[model samples]
Each structure stands twice: as structure tokens, then as C-alpha cells.
Target: MAKNTTKNTEGQAPKGVRKPPATRKTAAQKKAEAEAKLKQQQLETGEGDNTPTDTPEQPNNEPTGETAEKEVTAGASESSAGQEGKTTETDKIKSDANPPVGNSTIEDLSDDEFDKGKRDGVSDDVEDQELMEGQMKLEDDGSTKIGDNPMLTDTKDKEEVQPFVRKTKIEKTSSNVSIKSLFKEWKKDQALRAKYRQEAEEAIKSGLPAPEFEDETTLRFDLAIQRNETWTDYQKSDLIHTVLYGYYLQPVLVEDSNDGKKWFIDGKQRLTTLMTFIEGQWALSKKTKPVYGYKIAGFKFNDLPSEMQDEIMDETITLVRIKNMTVAERDEMFVKQNSGTPLSKIELIRAMHSELSEQIDIELSSLKFFKEDLELTKKAKDKFIDVELILQIAMLIEEGKDRIKGLGADNYKEYVLRLKETEQIFSDEMIEKISNISNYLTLAFEDYEMDEVKKALKKVNVPIIFWTAITAMDDNLQPKLFGDFIRSFLISGYSVESAYGKSSQAGSSKKENVLIRLDEMSAALSQFIDMIRNASSIEEGVEQFNKHLADVNGVDREEGEDGERESA
Candidate 1:
């Protein structure tokens, strides 16, 4: 090996020397060399004409060649040893300045360069200083001179940079807040009324009509079509308590008539209670809590403080409106509205509007016999019991009790329906006949003074009395005689177990029972009328009937004693 000293001519290493491994440059040396090469190229081509040609160089500004490489390697080794697991500031800056290939840091790269880097798996850093300078120039002159990178240029010059506008949150005002909160604030601010008054005055001074606020509580009733009063005082008091306590109230239903009137379709009771209470017609119940530090129990609307009064007036009532409906449709709607609390059969019949129903309501119900003689309470009248009785009487008179099948509830409903379909007009003669019969009945009951008979006459026995009177008496029939005949017939039925008593006791509404009762009563009445015809006075006739009743009682007592002895 020592003898082989001949060198290879092509600059190859000598045989067996294994050419000492080539020196590898550190990252810093390579970066320095690349910068030197770029400077030399720029100088040779005169590309950087602004370079200071006469600038003096400083001593030891930088190392050169092998010495620079040696220094760079040694410095890198020292840095590597010192910062084994940490990155220095200078190293970080250098790393950021020279990002790895395919990194997303070079935003201003040309499309061609980007594509080439993508294909070659290499990326180069874009000089941020150059890009920033180009951007500043472009902004200054509104020109596109951002090097060769079209990505940095603004293509849409006409597009505006929209200024961000933040939405403002709405603040709750007194008018838009909850009613409870509004009332609370109103109570605290006692000057609210003065404020409103001042506003009204200003409005008037400005030649504008003073603000006329409509009261929501003011509602009208169509007396002919609306239902009668059915709510009791206790019910009204409960509603008043609900109002005082601020409980939710259901909305009132109304119909806007063609005549520009608002009529109540439903909620009559509720609306009326509210209106009456506000008008001081009734006092609040004991259940009402102290409102605004004042005990409102047993207090009228006038007794309340002005603030509480205003709160009641300011109470909001929702209204649902219907328009242009017929009576039948209204009736159907009323039934539907009151489905929860059902109406009575007679009430429902009355709701079915017809000329006859109207006559019963206006004429018949208003008659003295029905108004005074029936002895109906306000509640009974409100339930339409009077109307039902009067309607039944009228039907019997018109149909001639013999022609009617029965006077049960179902039969009565059918008759009402028939009346509606026919729109039957009752004649003056029929009406007069009914009135006379009613008058006779009233007078007869008043003069007879038989408590048991009179009591029976008020209820189911009324129709039988009417039938008997019509059958037995004529136009010239004396009231005294007629009264005497009725008294005798009732006494005979009461003193003995006769057909009248049996028929009147049970199944009274049955057709056969009604006929039997009528026949028995009419026969007795006929015989009494004939017996009284010869009598000199009503007293004499009554005396004779009493004697007859005594004889019948004597017979019954004898029979009862014999049966008692047999049992013993």
C-alpha cells in the first residue's frame, strides 16, 4: 500500500484511499452562500441600480470561504449542544423566515409557482417585505403592481368594504311590558293620572279632539235573542273575586250586527257581572284580597281608591267577534259555546228562534197571569220555566188538548219545532180565548181559598183545570159558579180515591193518564155546573158540594175501620 503512490489523472482518489467523505454544509452556510450568489448576480446584471456604489465596507463585517464554513459548523454544533430540546429566538426567526417546502405560509406565491411546488413537493418563502411594499404601493395609487402574484391584487375594485353594524337590543317600555309590571309601576308613580290629564289637555289645546278612549267593558245585549239571567249572586261574587285577584278571564264572544251594533253572542253573564260591578251595582266578595293596602271586601266600586278603580277600568278584556249570522246559526253557536255547562231543554227550545218563541217571550210571559199568578221566583223565571208553562198552555189551547198525543217534554219539543217550520201565526181570537181562560183561572184560584186545591192547580194539575173549564163552561158561564164547580171537582178527587187523584199522582204526562184525568175532571165539572145552575148563590153551591164530600168521606172512613177490625 505504501508503494502505490501514482495519482489518478481525472482527479479521482488514489486506490484504497476511500476518498475522505465530502464536507457537508450546515443550514446557515448554505443560506449565506445563496445570498452571496444572489448579490453577485444582481451586481453583474445591474438589476439593483440603487445599491450604494461608493459605500465603504466595515472591517470583519462577515467571514468568507472555508473560515466562514468552519465558523458556521462550530457555531451550529455549539447551538445544538446548548439547545438540545429548546428552540432559540434566532433559530425560531430563521425557521419562520425559511418555512418547510409545501408549507401554507407562502400566501403570495404565483399560481405557477404554487402548482410547481405542489407537483415537486417543494415550497419557497415569499418575501413578506416585498409583498408588503407592493401592497402599500397598490393602496397608494389604486394599481395592481403586486409583483407577479395576481392573488394579491384586488380584482373587484367596485366592491365596497361593508362597515359592521351592531344591532341594538330593544328596551322594555311601560306600554309594551306585562300588565302586572305596568300596574306595579303605575301604583308607584302616582303622577300617572296627572300625566294622562296633561296629555289630554295638550291634545285639546292643539286643536285635536281630546283622546277619547273606549271602555272595553261597555257591551250591549240583544234582549230578544240573548239568554235570560241564569247566574246566581254567589257565581257573580266568585267572578268578582277572580277579577280582583287578577285571574285569567275568558274572552267575550260578540257579533257585529248589520246595523253597526255589537251584540253579545256569549259571555252575557260574565260581561254583565263585570259591568254591574264597575257601575257599583254590587259589592266585592269577602274573598277579595286587600288591593293596594285597602280592604276591598264588601266594598263597592265607588269605595275603592282611584288607583284601584283605574286598574279595574284598565283591565284588558279580549273579544272574539262574529259577523252576519242568522238566528239559527247563532243558536247553534250558543249551544256549542255552552257545551261545558249544558242548557235546559226548555232553554234550548227558547233558543230556537221562531215567531212563536218570540210571542211566548214578549206577550205570553209578560201577561199578568204568568207574571203574578204563577208565583215564580226570579231564578225560576230566569230558567224559562214560566215561558215553558205558558208555551205549553198556548199549545194546548191551540191544538185542543184532545188532538194532542201527550204533553211530555219530547212532545213539547216537537211542537216547538212544528211551530218553527210552519211559522204559525196565532189569531186574535185564540189569544183572547187564552187570556180569558188565564183570567178565569186566576180569579177562580183567588176566590176558592182551598189551599190544597190551589197548590195542586199551580203545578201539573193546571192543564187539567184549564181543560175542565173549557169543556164545562161557556161564554155566559158565571165566575162564581165556575169557581164552585172547580172546587167541588177538586174536593171530590181529594176526599176519595177517584180517577182524578190516581191520574194526577203518577204518569201525569202520559196521554192516557192525561185523557183519564181530563175526562173525570170534565164529567165532575159538568155535573157540578148542572147542580149549581139551580142553586141561588155561590155559597149555596159550595155548601152542597161540601155535604157531598162529607158523605164520600164517611163511606171511606167506614170501609177503613172495617178493614182495621178484620186485621185485628
Candidate 2:
């Protein structure tokens, strides 16, 4: 080689020459440095005297200083090289503190512990070196890691994270009154009022007995009688306009009570509208027509002009009087008066004034479960469907589910008629049974949080469940068992297919379907009740029932396939 001397920079290495890597401090060197730094800090703080002069006593057979360091280094090197057969002293301490969870059999661990371990971090079977590496990465970079685990950061939107808000239940009102009948009755009363006014004039001239119409004011409503219908906002507003615009208003039909009270038999809607308006209880609708060249919409009684107010207050409402009317007769007349436009069957049933109807209206309909928990639709409640359901349950109890075919219109009507004709009431036992069943159902639904079941519950399912509970359930059968049975039977796929599915598909009201459903459900409930009664605990009973149900479903599937093949 040619003689060539290269001059390098003061601190730089020669070009094309590699620099040596920095040497790692040995364990003893690191310990000595740490002790020296601690001594320096203590001396600066004037607390060096308290420093211990002797090393803390080590446990027997435990390695210390150089021997321990050499063993740890060798173990680490082996682990890093993928030899996991030997455990180091550090690993032994960790194993003592948190026993190797993976080495323990699954049956040895409690459900809660196992689940917590899974949620807390990685499995213990993972190599100790790898876990340390992960922990080191986490400590060094201030980031979470678990052996290349995927991040589970929340990706939900604000709306998804917000607490759920339940939909408001529909408003229920019994205000589907018949305006057509009111108009027809108004026309007939107009003719009668004209005839009566002529007669009153003649009677004043010839000194004869004359018909008299009561003032629109001073009229009273009898609270004893349940009016079959109520006026809608539109009907009340239209009546207000009719009176304000000088149209003739219908006369109220009243029955003279022995106590001298004018019991309203008909025209309640019209009379109430006018009277309520005069009392300033309500205002005119925004859609009210203009009157006397003035916009009257949103006007209360006091808002009307002086003359118009006087006209409304001074208007004569002919009171058609009858005497000695029984409650049934009164209800019948009320129904017939509104016959031009029919009321709902349940509404008609409510108007029957039967003991059963009274019980359903005054007692059953007022139940917390029936009113709030059942959460019937607006139309259903407006039409007295709750009342109807109570009656249906009562009927099932009294007539025996086998005897009753369906809960059709005719069946309910007949039931109400029979109760009226025979002057009978639902037995105390029957009423209590119905109430108990309803309360039980409410509690069951709530305890299990079975919102879906409640929403999908149809009218047809009511009687079947009621009958099943009545026939199969008893004091020995716990409420939990009952709830579980009901929830499973109503919602579980296999139970639905085997019992409620086919019958509820169509013609649920048919006698055969009703009986079949009744039979199937009754059998299932009976078996469940027996199972719960014989079992030690409700949970055990439920588990056994579920297993039995699964087995039954398997058999049913096999039989179904066989049947299909034969049919083909």
C-alpha cells in the first residue's frame, strides 16, 4: 500500500471506520452507582446519619448480589432466545403474587375471576419475556400495548352514548262522541222547540198549560250516570261557533230525579261545550269561523263582544224531561239516541250499566297495572279495550276456558247481556283472581325487563295466559318461576313454534285454535310449575326447563322433517 496519512476532525472518527457501541453497566456497577447517588442526595439534605449501614437481611436460600444477577441475566437471555422451560427468580416472585392463571384448570376458577382476568390483561401462558417487553414498551413510550392487541377505543357517536329515552305513551280519551246524532237530535229538537214556543204563546193568550224550556244556565249534570261518549275539540269548537253565529243549539235531555236533580240523558256534549265556554274553562279553536264580521278564533267567553256574550248566556236550551228511568233504561236510551252513529262495542258494553261493566270501569280500569303498565294504545283505551280485556279475563274465569270459544264481539255482548239479565256480578273470587293475575303479570314483565314481550303481546294472548295461570299456577309456584315460564313460553323460539306460533298465525279466535293454544300452554305451564315445585331453587328449575324444552324442540324438528318427507 502507498503511504497515505489522513487527518481527522478533533472529535470525529475516520471516514469508513465504524464506532464501537456503548457498553451497558453491569448489575454491580449499577448498584454501586445508585448507592453513591443516594448517599450524595442524603448528605446534601443532611439526613445521611439515618441511612442504614448494613444491607437488609435477605430471605434464606434467596440469591443476592452477583450470583443473583448472573442467574437473572442467564434466565433473561434464555427467555429472549425463546427458551421458556426455566423460570427466573423474578418470575418466581410474580408467580407467587399472581399465580399462573392459565396453568390452573378452568373449573378451579370462579366465573367472576375468569371474566376479570380476561378483561384485565393478557393470559399468563404468554412468555414472561414477551410480557416484560410489552410492559417495557408501555412504560418507555407512555402507550398501552398487549402483544399486538387491537385498540378498543370508543367509536360511538354522541347519540349512541346518550342514555336511552323511552317514547311517550299515547294519550287516552273517551271522547269519540257522535256529532251526526247530535245534529239529528238538534234538528228534531228545533221542530219541537218551535211547536213548544207556539204552544207557550197560545197558552199565555188562552190561559192553558204551556211547555217551558230551561235557561242555558242553571243546568246540572248527574255524576251518577256514566255518559257513553264525550265531545272532541272540533265538535266543541263547532258548537261554540254555531251558538255565537246565531245557529240554533240542541236541547239537553234530562231525567227528573226525586232529589230534583236534572240528570242528563242526552246532549251532554253540546250542553257541556256551551256551559264550559260560559265558565271560561276553554277557548275557541284557532280554526273557528268568523262571526259578526269579527274573527272569533281563540276567543273565550269573556273575549266575545257584549251582545254576543249576552246572546250565548240568554240562549234557551230546551230540557226534554222524563221520569222514573232505571239505569239500564237510561243507558239504552243513550245508546239509541246515538244510534245514528254507532259507538265502539266496548264503549257500548261500558254503557250497559251492568254490574260487570261497573266493576271493570270503577275497579279494574283503575288498576295501576291495567292503566299504566299494560300501556294500551290510544285507540284501544279510548274504545275501552282495557275494560274489554278485564271482561274477557272475567269471562274466561267464570265460563271455563274450554267452554268459551273466542272473545268476539258477539261473545262479549252475550256475556254482558247475561250478567244484566240475570242480575249477577263477577264473583269475589273471580275478581280477585283477575286482579292477582294482572298484578303478577305486571311484576313479571318488570322484573325481567321484557319490553319486547310486552310490545308484541296481542289481545288474543291475554285470555290464554290468564287461563293458564288460573289453572296451573298456585301458591307453591313462585312468582319467579311463573315469570320465567311466561317469558320463555311467550318469547323463546322453540316454545313459540311448538305452542303459540301456529294458533296465533290466523283465526286465533276460532274455537279449535283457542282450545289448542289453551291446551298447549296449559300443559307447558303445568309441567313448568311441577318442575319448579320439585326443584330446590328457581334458577335450577328454570335451567332444567330450558334443557327439557331444548330436547323437545330437537324431537319436534326430527318429527317435522319426517312428516315433510312423507308428505312429499
TM per prediction: 0.54, 0.52
Tens digits of lDDT, candidate 1, 58-135: 244332433333433444566768855443333333333433343332233445444333222332333243533333
State how far residue 77 of model 1 sits from its true place (Å): 99
Count of backbone collisions in candidate 1: 0
State which candidate has the highest TM-score: 1
Q: Against the correct fold, how does model 2 do in TM-score?
A: 0.52
Residue pairs in clash, model 1: none
